[model samples]
Target: MSTTTAPEAAEAPAAPQLSHGLKQRHLSMIALGGVIGAGLFVGSGAGIAVAGPGIILAFVAAGLLVMLIMRMLGEMSAAHPASGSFSVHAEREIGPWAGLTTGWLYWVMIGVAVAVEATAAGAIMHSWVTGVPAFVWVGIFMAFFCATNLTAVKNFGEFEFWFAAIKITAIVAFLTLGVLGVTGVIGHAPGTANLTGRGGFLPHGGDGLITGLLPAVFAYGGLEAVTIAAAESDDPRRNVANAVRTAVWRIAIFYIGTMALAVTLVPWDDPDVVALGPYVTVLQLLNVPGAALAMKIVVLIALLSAMNANIYSASRMVYSLVTRGLGPRALAKVTGGVPRLSVLASCGFGFAAVLAGYIWPDTIFLWLLNSTGVAILVLWLFIGAAQLRMRRRVERENPDLLTVRMWAFPYLTWLAIAAVVALLALMTTSADNRAQLYAAGVLVTALGAVGLWHQRCTAATAATAQEPGRTP
Candidate 1:
């Protein structure tokens, strides 16, 4: 039986084939846009509220973790580029169950994010034109993206390029404004006094600093999308490495630098910090005319851009999973090098979530967010575990395949796993994030069961085929 299994494994096909459809520019811009999200534009206010001026520290801490995760993922992706990214790595390194779990979890994450982004865009649109209902705008946004994704990959790349450009331009403008404000070049110098003025740098003590990390960590969630996008690029390994290398610096500079300026320009404890968006607050402090209106436009663009990317990523991931035999095979087919049916199926759930949000107007969206939050956690955990296993396997199988490698190999991989565990443990202690911890536990258990079942089924099928002279 062992001898028979060996030949079957040896004859198994190489990983699923994907069209090298995306370009380097598309990937680079995706990386840039990944680091900029509604969180940086609107949601950083929550972090500022918790940690006072020490939110800078939170951004730095979270950025480091993101950098580490990207490095581990890059190593695996460079060696075996695939559309599924970490999900493919999980199957090769860990087991089939790991792939199933991480793939489905990530699919849920992208779906929920699409709904969240669409809702955010709708809110902004309704604010601008009270006569247009939010649900109408939501439907419009979904329909537009569904068409975009169903087109050829190059067209999708073109769309992402512009979408990412808008968000990147906004961040650059915000950073420039911050520098001028800090140097006292724009009106009176707000000075660094806001940092220590209200409650000192560490006003709320270590607890506040730790509490601030929750949102800061969440802000970096989208960066991994770049690695997945890299699989479809013409030069997968080179582009993935370049994007990962450059994106780390951009995230730190843009996210940490902007948050530092934000906390410095205005008192972290200011009442308006929570009410008005942080970026808008900075503009208002600079006394820029119509700054609030300008920021609303930027936020709307940011939300739309995120929605577009999430829809694309979700569809591509499902297509990849299906090709690997982990999902419905029909989804794996490509028409004009685009998975048309898969794109629609992926967006269908997102549209449903949006409709549910509109109907309930309250509870459903929050539950969706909670359920999907666990998915992000599961994804990082799998990336870390898969990298650890794959690194060793690569050394044994192909020692020359270390052109782009993780910094510390097994050590860094283990540390990343520890960091994921710590974050999960920390989530349990938070009133708001505790629900995510429970959800993550349920997901992990379900994945484990499914993996075991797949292994048994495969073994049984192999044994049955051997008993009869009936070849599979």
Candidate 2:
């Protein structure tokens, strides 16, 4: 897992190489599927319980912020696509230190998330087949995805396509069924009772709406995967631009629209609602046939889809670092430009996290989860900063290359930056979120220190090498 480079291979990569194996269909589905995380299906219950039916407004606000961030990211990604993604942008617009810091932090975050997803999938399996140990199921899921990633880039795309398809279909079907039930078209649902009776939509007042914003912001975290996946796309510029523009609105529809139906069909304060997950609770009330089993299947697909997406993004990121001589040299080796070693390393970290979860649930295990809690904000902060600089440079020097410009130029971009700052500030208000903020602070600090040290070493080595030709 150490990123140390081998002596002989510790040189600049000869080329930035990767196969353009991801098809247009894969790119489209990745954008759609990225937003439909398993967390939304299960974890949203907690957010709803806190915010009440006013959660829809909270989602709208957060969704708008994300739309702006994507605009900034899309602007840069289209002009210059690389597997390193925001890291590559950071290096060009900010410095190598920023790129290395963001790249490794995000890379490690993705690896950790893989473990989290595997554990979630395993739990669902445990529910069905009560006899099997959850850890064993986690191992099988990890291995299955590992093999899927190790073989070929195209194979990864295919796997993700089907996985995403199932997730998307389930969400759509849920929305449809929710509407029917609320209207008494099918099943028993008290229309508007949940939304209206729930303290007139804001059980906890405006504070509840603000409270709902936290989960909504977090839920929108995975949309950045589209930009990352666009690098290996056939036409990076167009693909990135297309995905960003199209995915943003579609994601808004899926997230906000789904929340509206959920809150309408199921009251926010229903007993044991959060414990059962709102989807399951609603389906049970509506008396859907095999609702429990069907919903469980959907949840499993959601987890696996996330696993596939994160593993792909994490490996590509590490491969980017190695290609640029930022990590271990062995990871730079690519067969069919897939960087199989990098994938293995990424999955390895995930499995290691799984073991840590078993050994130290309260200590290291909790830290592992909290450490990357605010990474989405950190990434957006960098993206916003990088865009503020890169936008001017692109406009002045490479005007024609600016395919996907940030809307309203600096105005909206800066607005997005301010929103991220506000979200981070607000996150501290809750004890639960405060733990995440504190842990993320430690992580950013550690990465920053390492980045500075690496920068200094690179500088010193260059200075010494140049001294050999001195005339003195």
Candidate 3:
């Protein structure tokens, strides 16, 4: 028998196929769970406190912006679906440098997000086991969910489906009961008593409305998970298109409608609305049975679900980066059609996030979170830019695959980019959030510089290899 050498062993390929196990329901639920999160459940209180009833308008504005971003993303994903989502598109349409920066930046954001979500869940779950510490809870939650993600794509999908279903059910129930209570169906006759009773719609005036817009936009952050999850489905193109459409409508309804209901059921001026959380305050006012406890459970579910989704997304993105020659190629190796190494690597950030929070909750952790403050905004801007270029290529190469086209092509695409920039500019005006915006700007600048350096090195290395007399 002939012995194979090291070269031969190095040439052997590992498994690379990703399992397509996500079904229609899985896609639907992932889409739902991605957008509706703890942000909406709890974070909206800040906006409600600031804008009062006008928070509904803020949600509408942010929702529309999100819709535009989704449309641009859907168009690209439909034509060419990739687990990397916008990062892959950026590479093809923009440049290798843009893709590198965007992918790494997005990965960082999600990694941090995973840790934050775990910490939040751990805090809430601390009550169940008095002796066990919060960090241990974070570790346990991260380990268990990471295992599920490492097992099969379908497993992640199923987990997210149930997770999202619970959130949706809670939101729908709250909206229904709140609406009935506000309309006086539960007590008094139908009226706008709670809505205008406080200080009219613009309680704090237009500045409050503007202030509310930023939080509303951030609340829509996890939406890109649907597009990322699309690659694990059999009919990714069709699934993404449908999911995008429905997700848009649901965001508008759940965000705008829920905000409207919340403010209407419970006066926005009420201290409990902000201090106790808008959802809980509204539900308690309606006297829903065990509203506080139920909402607590729901918040935990939402955070954990988001953490699970992020773990899956970040792993896929890293796997895509490796396949594209932008990451450690070892991560590209697939076990059971899952990027197990990437999953482990992505989940590793949980420790870093926890440590940062522990070390300096006010400074270091704040910076880490703030550094990603405008990350979603930056991601959207890049996606819109990618769509502008990719659209022409898709039309020329495979027009038939243009099942999900961006609205108005280059025209609307430019508008979306401009809108995102405007939002960033708007962010700088807010004293509380400006530090985060500036920190994100600095982070983005560094990423761009590093990406440029990497590009130059790659080009130089390629050129040297082409020279017959030059040694690499």
Candidate 4:
């Protein structure tokens, strides 16, 4: 393996490029499934609890924000395709400090996300077969995904393709059932009873709706995974463009549509909505046989699918960072077009998180989860900032590179940034959310300081080497 740093690594002959093993179909399915995760399947119940039928509004708001973010990311990514995605754009258009901060923060966020998904999946399985321990299930899941990601990149794509297909099919079927129940085709239509009877929609008022935004936003976190995968596809530019173009419908159908159906079919205050999850609650309300078992099977698939993709994304992210001379050179080594070392490192962190759960289930484990809870919001800020600068640079230096453009130029870009800032402020105001924002803040600040310091030192070293009297 080559042990070259950033500036030198660019010239290193041994530094291998990632393979274009992903196909358009893989990207298409990934784009569809990226937004539909355990977060939407399981976490949306909390949003409903807070916002009632108004949760639909919260999801729509969050969905629009994510759409804007995706547009900006697609603009930059299609212009300069790379496995690094926004990290590479950040470094070039912003600075090395920005790149390091964005890449490493995302790597940590996604790594923790892997643990989150595994834990959720394991708990679901353990519920079915109580004899097997939850942590044991987590370990099994972690090992399985680690092995999958360590092979050729196509294996990851194929896994995600099928995993996504299963979940998508399940969601479509659920929506179809919801439509039937709502129109009285299958069962008695509640006829707006569920939505209007329960405190008349905005039960908790505007504050509750604002509070609901936190989870609503978090559920949209994984949509960026498609853009990250774009670099490995045969046509990064076209694939990314197509994926972004379809994000609107995907978010509408999967997120906003589901929230609407969930709130319409079942009372928002139903305890089972929170306890049994919204999907199962709706199924049970409609008198579907084996509702719990059916949704549990679907939820398990969603969690496991998300876990696999998170590991793959985290590994590729860190691998991109290391290849640019940001971290350990050994991790940058790509064999068979896969960064196997980075895969292990990502899965290792996830397994460590599992142990943390066992050792300190209450304090330490909660902190670990909270720390990553808001990391996606921070990375979105980076994507928006990078796009703001890169759009102009590309237009001036290489006009044709603007294969996809951010809508409304600087205006919408500014709007996106301001919206993120507003969400962060809202997070600080909530007692439940305050801890998560603070934990994420501490980690991001630490990483930013280190990135800036490293950037300055690298600059000074380069200047010194260029001096006339310097030794060659």
Model 1: per-residue Cα lDDT over 1-472, one tens digit each: 0112222121123334446778889998888886578888888998899899999999998888888898888788777777788887877776666677788778877898898889889878988789999878988999998898888777778877887888788788888988898898997887668987877998899889988987888888888788888878999888998888888878788889989989988888877788886898998999888888887887787788888888888887887777766778877767776778789999998998887777865577666677777567678888888778778778998967666788877787788789878877888778778887766567667767886687568668888887867787
TM-score list, all predictions: 0.94, 0.94, 0.94, 0.96
Candidate 4 lDDT over 119-151, as tens digits, reads: 888898898899999988998999998999988
Candidate 2 stretches greater than 4 Å from native? 1-16, 187-191, 467-472
Model 4 misplaced stretches (Cα beyond 4 Å): 1-14
Span of ten consecutive residues with least summed lDDT in model 1: 1-10
Cα RMSD of predicted structure 3 = 5.4
- Backbone clashes for every candidate come to 0, 0, 0, 1
Off by over 4 Å in 1: 1-18, 361-364
| Predictions in order: lDDT | 0.80, 0.84, 0.85, 0.84
On a 0 to 1 TM-score scale, where does candidate 4 land against the true structure?
Answer: 0.96
Ranking the candidates on lDDT from highest down gives 3, 4, 2, 1
**Residue clash pairs of candidate 4:** 6-325
**Candidate 2 TM-score over all chains jointly:** 0.94
Model 2: lowest-lDDT 10 consecutive positions: 1-10
RMSD of each: 2.8, 3.8, 5.4, 3.0
